[model samples]
Target: MTTVEPPSWQSLRAAEARLINTGVPGVSVGNAVFESIVTGLRESLLRLAAPQQAQALGVPPVVSRGLLERVGYIDGFPNLVGTVYSFTGSGADWNRLQEARAATDAAWYQEQQISEVALLPATCHHIYPLFEGVDLPGPAVLTAEAHCYRHEGTHELGRLRSFRMREFVRIAAPDDCIRWRDDWMEQQRAWLTSLGLETSVEPASDPFFGSAARLMKATQREQELKFELRVPVGDGLVQAVASCNYHKEHFGEPFGIRVAGEPAHSACAAFGLERIVLALIAAHGDIPADWPQHVRSVLSLDDAGVA
Candidate 1:
């Protein structure tokens, strides 16, 4: 395994701003410079999506716990899954929490109970359930934005516990699904390359949990069901900034969604928005003005309305 190094988060903020090392280890707080660059990134993606006629959609941050199970998230990635908890009790119970906090600051969380919902792990997970029990005579494409969370065993610069995600989903015939994923993967690689970042597309698999995970990962890689666009940050370490996944009846079978009288095949391309922004900063610099002219032009960073 390659050693993961701590990221230079200080570069995420302006000169006068506080360092990016906020209280939370894997949480991010960006400065104006960072936000502007992020906007450009989002806009660039939207423009590319415009040609596909992908409908724009949005998903809530918290997802139904039962829904998470339906999506097989808990079974496949129980280690990375995060569940929400809340205090649900009368005034007397609140008093007990307060008393516990008074005794020890960390003990207060013990009073909270797990809620019905879990934090959204991936933006595309929500898309499947929306079409449950429905039939699609033709292919459908959707684009959505979500704030996702994962429980990371290790925290580093590019690996985050909470982050922004943008996903493009497709549900159709198996061949159509595969073609869509492949086409988008190529477009995404080109887009990132145009921004002056060196990128590599490689076969990949999810970090599956449990003893069977090893065999499952091997099967996934052998079948070429997933591909990732990996890039290097400031450090020597490399990470996947985007992924294209083809799920043949994975969600369709569970959700009873069909296309053309058959269980639909699905695919999605997900972008880790913050990770790409960080890669840009590492390749160029925090200052957008100092970036290569072509990179800036591709991102529209200098457009009068970009800010």
Candidate 2:
């Protein structure tokens, strides 16, 4: 049997650079066609969620540092966190900063104070806190898209330092939350197949930092709390384009979100917007004009209506 190997990161990166401008190492400015695919995928997700009366929210790209700490983000993935810092210096400090800048003293920027908010690591992170101290009469569903950041050093085609995530979060009883996630897993697979991408849903775990995180990862997988929808990105690697996570009272207890006087169970379906676009490009090639009719039609590329 002949096996088709995945493309390498170098090849994908080159293709992306040709198709979209990548002035920043881990960030890129997508062309019109690129944006169209992203928008179409995002819209498709929204359409899939139409049955549920999900309250749509537009969360800020940055969230308060205090909130992040409360959610244990600092304890778990501190390495990936990005803090916003600004120049809060007086006149003398400003003068010193300018002088240091002229001399190319990188350390001079450290004089600035850290801002109250930090770049959001995920779209769902900010949603859970909003329900704090509220007793959910029933299941609450929230849909949001936000720019997220991670400080992972390596930047490849599918992996980015900063990216966009479209998330659907459900806060409800344990059974309801699990069912919602499983249903969406199947639904998401069907949608991805419609877009002509081969996908698989498998048990997964987060990249928890530090030596102790090994136990956390094993526990997560053992409990089957996380699952990912993976698509071939390149170099024999399948990247996670979306994930279904079951946080069993992890966020609820910390945030005081209760349902029926008990701590609510929360789950989220998160889609990596840029990775989906990259997968589409990898599967169909970068040229929109040469893509399959179905692909173009699904993405609404012919009419430029995706935006």
Candidate 3:
């Protein structure tokens, strides 16, 4: 067997410093990094969208509990939702909430429902439902960035309880949907190539909710249905730099994202902007001169003018 080497000292140092700086639970360099990635990602995605397609929209930071419930998220994966609740009274309740959380208090909190709201789980969840019951002249594309929240157990450096996600979504007839998914992957591959990253296209499947998740992954190789572009980040960590997903009719059915008159098909390509930035920083170090000249030049320019 080939011996595995450790992550590069330079890259590890940078990852540590950056990760520590950004990983604050509610605040940290994580926010700043997220902001920077979102800014660059939006510019890049908008460049690839159809000219007359629907303009980009910013989804609400938080999706309502009811909306998520309607979509069956609560039943499918309650563990991943950050539910909003309140203490029963005014001062006493406020004090109770402010105290450091202990492991043993699950039911006590449920007694208080000042309002039932949930932090948004996925950025695209807010945007996809906007097409419900609307008749459109033709296909539309939407690009959006949102700070998404998840209640999970992982406390890693790059992963966050809250992080920004940028997605380019298309809703239209079946043919248009398939073309959008296939074409965007090609465009994204070209773009990544220009950035000097080696990439591969591999089929992937959704992390379907419930027990079906495992079966779906095994039977249909659902994880392979969607293709991901990954770049090695030294060590053994290969960041999922970008992804082109074919949701087919899964989201369209629930959201009623119909075509001109028929039931629509929907698809989206999501770039883990922060992950991509991390990969770039790790592989190329922090110097601008190290990046491909074209990519570096684009990074130098503002949205208003090329540098």
Candidate 4:
């Protein structure tokens, strides 16, 4: 076996703690550490996602409600939360506008006005619509770095209302979609193994809405819908660092994404950049320099060489 420099588990944890939020639901330093981990993971995953000369693109932070509606987000998640903003009732009266705005500055607003486009609730929603009218001879692999927001009622320390998601999407035939997900699982397993961390890859149920949705998840063994690569975050906290989803024919029909002449099958593996970092910290204590040499080698951050 090749020698690898271990990451500094302690320093990494300290860096992670700095990013974590001690206040209400918002952004924080902990999130920053999470992003770092995500970036590292992405660099590794991209090698597998688009081995050839493939390009990566980014989409807008704000998305149209019409687009979200097309994806069944409204129907499925009636209570689905997201950020929506409407204009103030200033109505050319600068005085009133300032006074009203300063009074509370809450979500209270006037009616009969246009609401700015809703912030993206999920990162992948925007990717499918980008190629709504395109035709591809083979699969199109795209990676997106998107900031997502939701009108959350409660917020936890690590889980924020607004977060960043890095998604690796594959638009291809059914077989190709399945193959990509399978191959990715193997790749992720190796990566985590090299890190010297214990992990589990299990078939996961969908985030189906309502009570019946849970039943469906149970009945179908909904593994393809999502498979989670989870690592214990200590103290009974197991974090899902990566998710592999096989959309089957769900998205193709809605978005008109086709492979050849048939409706295409779509699959994607999403890495919650922040969550993965947290998991690493929880697993190995922080400090990239202290990480096992073998793990560090996989990340290409050997102390003797540049990361």
Candidate 5:
């Protein structure tokens, strides 16, 4: 039997280079065609969510540090969080900073003050806090898109330090939440198939930090709390392009979200926008104009005039 090897990081990188500009390690600047596909996908997601009556939200890239703390994000993934900092020093301090920079001092950045906000780690992080101390009259569904950041040690194509996530969240009774998530799982699978991408759904876990996180990951998978939609990117490698997560009462209890006097169960269907674009490029090649008719139409690139 001939076994095909999965795509290596170098192969993925080369493929990405042909479709987008990577000016920084682990970060990318999408070319016009790339951005067009992303925008079209986001619009399609919004249209699909419209029937659910979800309140569309455009969340800021930065979220409050306190909010993350309340939700135990710092405790769980402190290493992955990106804290914002700014120079808040006087003229003398600025002079010292300049001198330190000129001297190539390693600790020069220590002079800056940490800001109240940090780069948003996930799109759903900001949604929970909005329902704090309030009882939802019934189920609440929200759809949002945000630029998310993480401090990943390794940089690879589709696994970026900064990316965009489109999330459809539901805060409701446990049964309702789980049902909504499962339904979306099927819907997302169908949507990916419609784009002519080979895809699979499998149980998965978050990359939690620390030794204790092993137990958390095991528990998460054991409980089937998360499942990912994986697509072949290159070689034989498969990348997770989207995820469906059932938080149960995780966010509700922490943020004081209540539905009918009890902690509400929350679930989210999240789409990694950039990863989808990369998956498309991997499957269809760098030329958007040469992609299948259905794919181009779905992405609204049929008349985009891209060469």
Candidate 6:
């Protein structure tokens, strides 16, 4: 992986003209320039996943609460998971809700009840439940993109609460799974370099909450189960624009996903599209004409009349 000091690390609103911030905090909608870059990135990722014989798939944004519980996500990311709630009450309760709507939020929120489903924090979580109890002799390679929600409690650049995540997941034996992640780490370095983005692959871990979870976080880094492609996105701020993770029998044991009569291991390469665009804007200028020729060509910004 190539590492260099980025010339500039502008803040979130630095490229305000290129990205339209929706009134909702931590949410922004992309304009043409943003869309063009995202499209190019997605296509490039697909090309990289092609040789792995990855099957293209689509999954819903919301995952079942039971599924998350079974997967232990509710334990690890309880603070970040956005639980879905709805008004499942009687006519008297509805009347109370209408009355409380004009009052405080605490009163209205009491009218809502948690549902069986919650917004997904990652795409791969939804994939495993599908292959439950299935024996995969072939060791599946699947690719998909989904809108994920994580209540990170910040509207910081490249750290949106709600974001789109694209993933290439492989379920196989332990060694095979780890090798796939290692290979993709190198592949992503070269691919991001093609877009004129300087990135570093550094050992990283999830934002596991609570005092006890610190040990989990530390162990993850110590074992190098997760590695992030860090990109300079803000002043003194580096964000993970992509990540490769090795989940050793974590999903297989719960889902009963077997490979050659044993619980399969899993690994995935995940790309954060919006964050990558932010990195590009900070590296070059938000304007297409100001970007490097190779970067512009790779993103096909001019083909879409971005200039």
The window of 10 residues in a row where model 2 has the poorest summed lDDT is: 1-10
- Candidate 4 stretches with Cα past 4 Å from truth are 1-17, 30-36, 48-53, 88-94, 97-116, 150-157, 219-223, 302-307
lDDT scores of the candidates, listed in order = 0.83, 0.81, 0.64, 0.67, 0.82, 0.82
On lDDT, the candidate that comes out on top is 1
Q: Which segments of model 2 are wrong by more than 4 Å?
A: 1-22, 96-107, 305-307
lDDT of 3 by residue, 1-307 (tens): 0111233233332312133333245323432332443456567666656563656786877877888888767766677788877765788665665463454554556557745678888777887678887766788777877777777565443455666677888888877877778888898888777666677777765455676667766643543447887776444567566788766676778877667788877778887666666666665654434456666544543432322
Give the Å shift of residue 14 in candidate 6. 14
lDDT value, residue 253 of candidate 5: 94
Residue-wise C-alpha lDDT for candidate 1, range 240-302, written one tens digit per residue: 999999999998889999998888989999998888887887788766777898987877878
TM-score of 3: 0.77
- lDDT (0-100) at residue 305 of candidate 5? 51
Order the candidate numbers by lDDT, best to worst: 1, 5, 6, 2, 4, 3
Report the candidate with higher TM-score, 1 versus 4: 1
Q: For candidate 1, which ten residues in a row score worst on lDDT?
A: 12-21
- Candidate No. with top TM-score: 1
Q: Please report how far candidate 2 places residue 97 from its true position, in Å.
A: 4.1
Off by over 4 Å in 3: 1-38, 50-52, 88-114, 219-225, 301-307
RMSD, every candidate, angstroms: 3.8, 5.2, 6.2, 6.1, 5.2, 5.4
Looking at candidate 6, the ten consecutive residues that score lowest on lDDT are: 1-10
Candidate 6 Cα misplacement greater than 4 A, ranges = 1-17, 90-93, 96-106
